[model samples]
Target: MKKKFILLSGLATSLLLSGCWDINEAQRMYYVDGLGIDYKDGQYEIYLQLINFTNVAKSEYPNPQTVPAEVGQAKGKTLEEALFKLFRSIDQKVFWGHMTFIIFSEEALKDKNALSIIDTVLRYRETRYQIWTYCTQDSIKDILLLTPILNKSLISSKLSTPLDTDDQETFVEPVNFRNLVIGLNEPNHEIGIPYVTINKNWETAEQQGQDTTFIGVGVLSKSGFKGLIKNDAARGMQWMHNRTHRGEITFKLDGDETDFLTVTLEKIKVDIEPLVKNNQVTFEVVVKLNATLNGLKTNVSEDEIRKKIIKEVKKEIRTTYKEALAKDIDIYRLSEHLYRKNVKVWKRLEKDGKIPLTPSSISKLEIDVNQVNSGRKTFTGTFND
Candidate 1:
């Protein structure tokens, strides 16, 4: 009788546990991979790109191209409100658990209260803090539509992502939402985000016989869109942030001033020190880099080339750092470092009104770059030849 009672009770408990909590299957709903937000004329618009499962499945040797997923937009007074408006149109319950990318319009970012708008999305239990956030001067809708030609060429490729770990240094510095928040919450630090501009380069690439295209970058300070950082300035930002994981660096070759020697950054490290004097504040930025002799027009020995490389690399680092500081933007988080290192000093400066220490204060700066390694010799069949 005792055994029978115990078995019956266990069975009842098992039946109650078999509820809908664990039954949500992959096929039951749409998975969103990216979300775009824009603010215009006192209204908010939200964009969602949900993955199409049918296109994701079926792996034949020569499969047909997958159709691009549709984009959904909702508009309202706030981000969540706008998203909810779009949710009403979808059939399956839309799930953002898999979502990893969010783009904000430059205008949206300028609003002093922009944090409140983003808070709803970030505070959601289902949303991941690692989602990459981008700021663009162009319309968020326009930016979304400007997919890379190569990515669109392949049916299986994604248009936008959290941050492509492989090409992080060159194209865009993907800032996850959590990192941005931390930088913002820090007392003395201000946050910087990548600003993108879209053009007809996608179609131009196909017409001009090229597989890839260039997207321009805009700079953003605490005060909305500061200005555009075209070509070198944009690339310089990557160098300053120590985000140049792998990219070409060009300089005049030894004994051949007209010819160019291009070196590729193999590794890099950035360190910073903030010094607060009696009244003036100065920052020391140290960048250590390693590169290989990727290309050269002259036959200078490896050792000779390495010497010239160090001299040129330092000049490049300082020039870039100065230009960024001129814009009053600390693409490098010097303020954040000062806050962590000595909060008391920073507070003292602020209290005495001796230092103009606003969240957006421009830093007085210095830069130092050391080249650790130039190139390697392969022993198998090559030796200084």
Candidate 2:
């Protein structure tokens, strides 16, 4: 009985001891916060922002100041090769589960191997599918090296928190790795990635002074980079996609272009209907918005102002549609809507190589603006004093 008991104890001890053999210390692992990819001359450059958890965990109250992250880079012919090279050179093993976002340069998306790079990254077990993706026209190195000045944190809160904002201040809708892949696999295979840029004064000498700005939407067709829609057109793209939540519109109060009144959008609803007749495709877009009078730079009737706002909204939608048509890109995904609603008509059009929407295809657009709040009542001539 004593010998049997001794043998059981020895087996239990071995099992516990074996579990500790592969254990890794938390301090020995590098946690990545963000990743940036750039491609040039058939070479892939990978940039990683490593978070400093020690500083983040420090017990500092109210206005704690500490360096939050550091940047590292490695280059090779493919993403896996570049990542392996990066891991081999670093002293600590890199952990990507904490990675918050990924940015691809315009040049990187233009490469033929861009899809392969995305596949390689997604295949890794360490990377999360929820990481937000972006495309930038600026240098990927500059964007990766940017330090948050106002936020004064290790990671740039502006880049990380944009998707969570309740306001429509952000023009383009953010796409995650999983949705991007799903969109690419769809029948139309149309997707748009938000565009980012750095705004800085070259004359300024401060290191953490520059600000990152989201400028436009980068359109991708059939899993390839197509083009960009910038400025108000970007906002228009959001309107067409039914992604606008809360935004502001500035328009001339009357006939004077210099006099402007800004209205804050409280709510918006968009309806798109696709119709086919005589072998021709046309889309009708109707936009309805509820707004409040936020600014009044000139004295004008509220009724006239509401009319002007509606006209401006319609114009923006038309301009955005024309721009997309000119590039032969469908930012609105009307083709997908047609396929889902009327597959037979879509198939007939597809057989004729007309699955995508064109400029002349969008025949009608309508916009209605309702002023839900006019602010404090205004009296003319001080009550006849």
Candidate 3:
């Protein structure tokens, strides 16, 4: 009787384990790694970066014709409408579970209702909040279509590189939807996403057999792109966020001579102090950095190089900070300073303006950079040439 009871219990357990509740197979649908959204004229345009599985599988085998990816686009009155239209045109079911990027076109950001569109993406149950987000000075569609000729795998496989994230070396940092939402909800902070611009030579892109090409950055204020920020301005944005990891800077050594050096930042800290007196809003931004000299093409004394780096870094920081102030972007958390230091004034300021940023309020900018080490002299690995 005991053996019979045991058999019945085993049968019951097996019956409960039968099927998938929300199972999805990779083969059944096409994986989307990047998405671009743009608003032009009167419609919303959606671009999807689709991965080719067969070519990706054949990447190990040498074949030049195996292009890594393809692009698809569609337009509609609403975001979902445009997306569904794009899905219907594609041969396979579009799956965004593996998606890593989202790029917004300048036009899309122009909408006063831009935040509403953002709300749609975040509110979706299937959308992953951790995916990297960017803005493009050019059309979002063009940026999504960029695939290098040598890219044998596909767009989906290529975006995994760490370069996309903001480090000391890069001016742009990969800001995701989650970070944006968090900043928006915070009492005294603003958000900025990295920007991209399309490479001009499309025929060359096709002839060269590459998938996509882009450059520069898209700047955002409140609802949309305020304008495009390039070169030093972008660098300033990185400094404001205190996100520099590994960056290169050129310093003037002597007359008509300049030396290039790369530094890997070890630590960064920023403090914002705001004061209101004599009916004037005064802001003091202080930034501190500890860095290692990682690269140097021209040899120089350690002491000399250290001095040059500090001087150049100070100039760069001041210049960039000024640019941020000009744009009133507040890449640094100046609003947070006001809230923490003087809550009553911040409340009054908020009640006065829809866009709560002011350029004239800045009174001082101070930057300090300390050189830690000049990296190791000997490489651990053997180089066979």
What lDDT would each prediction earn against the true structure? 0.59, 0.74, 0.64
Query: Could you give candidate 1's per-residue lDDT for residues 1-385 as a string of tens digits?
Result: 9999999999999988857786668798887877787777889878887756665454222223655466788889877688778989998877877776677776777666577756777888888887766776666665554434443321232234423444634645666778777766654335556665554424453363222123434444333455444556555555556565666667776555587777776566667677777755566666666666654444566565566666665665555546666765555555556666767776666422123433223343333334534356321224335
What stretches of model 2 exceed 4 Å from their correct place?
Answer: 1-18, 58-66, 166-168, 201-208, 351-356, 376-385
Candidate 3 residues 85-133, lDDT tens each? 8777787677767677787877788777678788887787767888777
What is the Cα-based lDDT of residue 244 in candidate 3? 57
Measured over all alpha carbons after superposition, the RMSD of each candidate to the real structure, in angstroms, is 5.3, 3.4, 5.7
Lowest summed lDDT over 10 consecutive residues: which window, candidate 2?
376-385
Two-way TM-score contest, 2 vs 3, winner: 2
lDDT of 2 by residue, 121-160 (tens): 7888988788888898898778777755553454445566
- Models 1 onward score TM values of 0.76, 0.88, 0.76
Model 3 scores worst on lDDT over the 10 consecutive residues at 376-385
- Scanning candidate 1 in windows of ten residues, the lowest lDDT window is 208-217
Candidate 3: misplaced stretches above 4 Å? 1-24, 54-67, 148-168, 187-189, 198-216, 257-266, 276-279, 291-307, 351-360, 372-385
